[model samples]
Target: MARYIFVTGGVVSSLGKGLSSASLGYLLKSRGYKVKIRKLDPYLNIDPGTMNPFEHGEVFVTDDGAETDLDLGHYERFIDINLTSLDNVTTGKIYSQILEKERSGKYLGNTVQVIPHVTNQIKDFIKAKTSGYDFIICEIGGTVGDIESLPFLEAIRQFSNDIGKDKSLFVHLTLVPYLKSSEEIKTKPTQHSVKELRSLGIQPDIIVCRSEITLPKGQRKKISLFCNVNIENVIQTVDVKTIYEAPISFYKEKFDYQVLKHFNIKNKKQPNLKPWYRTKNIILNSKKEVNIFVVGKYVDLKDAYKSIDEALIHGGLANSIKVNLNKIDSEKLKKNQIKNKLKNADGILIPGGFGKRGTEGKIQCIKFARENKIPFFGICFGMQLSLIEFARNVLKLRNANSTELNKNCIPVIGLIEEWYKDGMLKKGDLKKLGGTMRLGSYECNLNEKSMVKKIYKSKKIYERHRHRYEVNIAYKNKFESKGLIFSGLSNNNKLTEIIELNSHPWFVGVQFHPEFKSRPLSPHPLFASFIKAAKNKK
Candidate 1:
């Protein structure tokens, strides 16, 4: 049986519960214990699939095509695990399933309530497909006192009793605000937060306190006394130079030791955190740096491209260089302002996004990057825009654009009307917008002589995608004749997966999102190559 560690937060939001959980999971995994991390969001959006990036941040897609919360990105990066849709559970997903069961008469005319029915659904989702794992760290989203999260909290409380306390552990993360003027840290908020959690019938076995500075011995004792936790189990987490240092920091504090002790499990081996230490050292001590401009619509919100941001850092780590990301909002970018905006750019990257809000500005940026011979990388929507830019400038196609932006213009890119997957036909609907894209991992065959093939050193590669539009293959011959390279193809040469410019110093675009798979230990080949190209340009 897998011991469950339920991570909950209080006092405020954005307390780094996800990171804390992932770091602990990494610590245990390094000590030869099988570990898995999951997220239980209290939101009612089914998933983050249809939610706006500005409101909910990036929607992380798993290999099985589930659009999940951005925290899953942190989990995957830290634990180095490939999670599936089953790892993420939300109130929206739980309620949707319950309603479907009710409509299908699965309840046999019984009145449904939140207690037995809804809570049962949440518990079931928690324990699904979790066999053979020594530990499962489940982070509950939202703060402790939020009304929407009450059901989830109650569900976990019930789960603890049902599974026996020995098989369950609750780790509560709370903030300890430090007043500069008073020069003292406050533990009152943590006390009240733990009190609130206790009111929900859940007592935390460990208290992870988030603070700007180290907690004094007095403050730690006070928190332990008020929160009803052991003094040794009260862990203090301060801001680190980089997030990758979190696991090492927590390991030094013996956070994993307390977790193992709680279950009365003995592990003789120590955690091997050499990879994290090396990654952190490289991140902080790297001398060379490259500036890259990431032009996108959601640039204002840093979390909007969380995975992309991390992936770039991973790429830089692989090259022993520091990546300076200048996030440029495409919607506000003017044609004349391109030079000033990207003046120091060693590389130009256009990340994935939806909508036509900043289409023209993105195309303008692509044109500047291409004409100036700056190393450029485009992904998903950015790739389509690159094709449009190429068609308008090189192919001399008048007013070239994607059908997503303008239906009347020349269809340099158009909606994927039909596609084949595993010998079965699939189609997307223009009316419905949720969970309908060509998502998850797909295989792409690389041209033997292509630049990507040289970078990846493989003829076939699999990448994850989350888009509805594809470049028209009929223009491939025209594009290839004009020095454009359609270097990768999927679905038996019908879909374009990668594109490059033959004449430029380094310009590439990929139809799939490679950022999802990039890791610090082993960065994705494309991002690593992109960083190397940027460094070479510098």
Candidate 2:
């Protein structure tokens, strides 16, 4: 038996609902309770895998290969939990499953509508994934009145009543915009958002007011009276210096205490939040600093590389330094600008992306880093382009390209048509580009003398991958002949998992995303090492 906390946002999207939910989960876990955070996206996309990074942000992949919303990344980083595919759901996925079941007569030849069919499915999903967890915090995506989210909203409403009021709690997060000119924080948006939620027959057990300034005297009371929530239950979530401080800030406001009080669950033990406090101290007191320029396609949106950005921050924390991250949009960079922008940087990074846009610029940047001996790190597409750059400049393969870009040329990179698993080279189907790819955790065997192996201090390690194309294995020997070390390979020795420059200061490209595994307490080894090298260069 577990308690359910349904967290929904209003006024507008991108209000840190995910962060708040994860922080609450962290607070709960600190109190000796098992906690799991889930994201219920209202998007019609089956998963964010096929979506553009500029639009939907990073498609966080679980260890089980489920492409989920970026909010799951926040949940994972904060709660330190390895979430599963079952932890995330979307309108597209739910509808796809329902249609499949309908076609198979799982609905018993009845007309399947959104009311009972969709709502029941949603309830079933929530209950199914809650097994063995003491607390499940589900953050519903989108605003309260979005047409796409109505089914999910109604589903949770019915669930709260059906499961009894004591078993579930609803937390509504809405904005209370501050008018600097008027010197007041308005609560009309919060009032209306709650009224809309009430129209759906779901009254929030707790109302979290998001504000830029402090909640003025009598504002909580006014919000409580108008929103129909108790004054003590109206919690103010103010902006913090760092997101890692959110759990502690909310704790100061007694957010979790109110939640537990609502549930009437006696405190079993006090929460140990020293880990968060310690990390915050490091961030606040770091004396040293280094600049790490990240050149990427989706540089316009920081969310596109949220994990990468955070990983770099964690790397700085590990080294007791401040990481100054500069985002340069590769699409707009000229040849001279690449050198101009990167000349002062201690480190350079190119993250994962799709398509051919800005690739030449990315290649130019990689070449500059390679020749300058700047500590460089490349991920997925970044790794692939490095090979192309190496082949063209080092191996004299001027026409080298990936099949994903040019299907007919000399393919240094090509689609992963098949993989050897369970003692078999299974044939692949490339008909769909949905959630299908070499995703999640896969073992990579490291060469004993490689720099990557030294950093990881392990001969065999597993990292999560998210790519449709891979470095062609046929060109391994030719690439290795040119001092392009295939430092790490898959368990079958057929897929290239890691690449490195043997003579450079610190140059490494990985097919898998190490950023996905980085944490605040213990940063990813690759990033921590990369930042250390950057510190050395500075």
Maximum-lDDT candidate? 1
How displaced is residue 500 in candidate 1, in Å? 0.8
List pairs with backbone clashes in candidate 1.
none
How do the residues 197-268 of candidate 2 rate in per-residue lDDT, one tens digit apiece? 999999998999989989975899899999999998999889888899999889988888998998898896
Write the residue-wise lDDT of candidate 1 on 1-538 in tens digits: 7999999999999999999999998899989989988999998979898899999999898888888999999989888999999999899999999999999999999999999999999999889989999998999999999999999999999999999999999999999999999998999999999999999899999999999999999999999898889999999999999999999999988999999999998888998888888888888888889998899999888899999999999989889899988898899999999988888999999989888998889999999999999999999999989999999999999788877788777777776563223322255533342234888998999999999999999999999889888777778899999999999998568789999999998899999999999988789989998999999997
Which TM-score value belongs to model 2?
0.95
RMSD of 2: 3.1
Instruction: Please state the error at residue 162 of candidate 1 in Å.
Output: 0.7
TM of each candidate vs. truth: 0.96, 0.95
Report how far off residue 480 is in candidate 2 (Å).
Answer: 2.3
For each candidate, the alpha-carbon lDDT, in order, equals 0.91, 0.89
Error of 2 at 499 (Å): 1.1
